[model samples]
Target: MINWKVRFKNRSWVMAFVAQLMIVAQMLLQGLNALGVTDFQLTDAVQQSILTFVNAVFILLSLMGIVQDPTTKGMSDSERAKTYKEPN
Candidate 1:
């Protein structure tokens, strides 16, 4: 079995995976609606809104990853000093 924690070690990877899942789910929902198995209404505006929200979430996750990266260190002095130190 695949361990999610090991496979998705970074927030960006996790967010991307989630975005893919959302895409698949949206497709499935649309298929179901076409087959008359669902009443889901994904109008252009609603679809655009959902896509925008997902993209925004991806951006936020990427920003969080950048903030916590060992390279960038941190935003403040105290954090920078601590981040530079070798982990024990």
Candidate 2:
């Protein structure tokens, strides 16, 4: 089973996933709009706001992820082997 805490520990991954999800949602909304089920217009203002928000969020996430201390990340293969005394 996947560990939710471990999977979501990386800010960059979460941000990128959210950004991609937004893209997929936009596509689905557009499809709905085309079908006359909704009026999801991509006006210049709306486009600028949503895209700008997503881009800014991604940038922030990347910066945060890069700034995290290395110790908090899982050990490297060499470090793990040395610490665990695994056979070669």
> Which candidate has the top score in lDDT?
1
Query: Candidate 2 regions off by >4 Å?
Result: 44-88
**Superposed model 1: Cα runs more than 4 Å off:** 1-3, 42-45, 48-88
In model 2, the clashing pairs are none
lDDT of 1 by residue, 1-88 (tens): 2244443555654656776677678779878988999986878898899878976875776666642334533433344334433322
Tens-place lDDT digits, model 2, residues 1-88:
3234543565644656676677688778868988999975789898889878976775676566642334444533334433433233
In model 1, which range of ten residues has the least summed lDDT? 79-88
Clashes of 2: 0
Q: After TM-score superposition, what is the CA distance of residue 21 in candidate 1 from its true location, in Å?
A: 0.3
Estimate the lDDT of model 2.
Answer: 0.60
Residue 34, candidate 1: Cα error in Å is: 0.4
Q: What is residue 39's positional error in candidate 2, in angstroms?
A: 1.9
Error of 2 at 15 (Å): 1.2
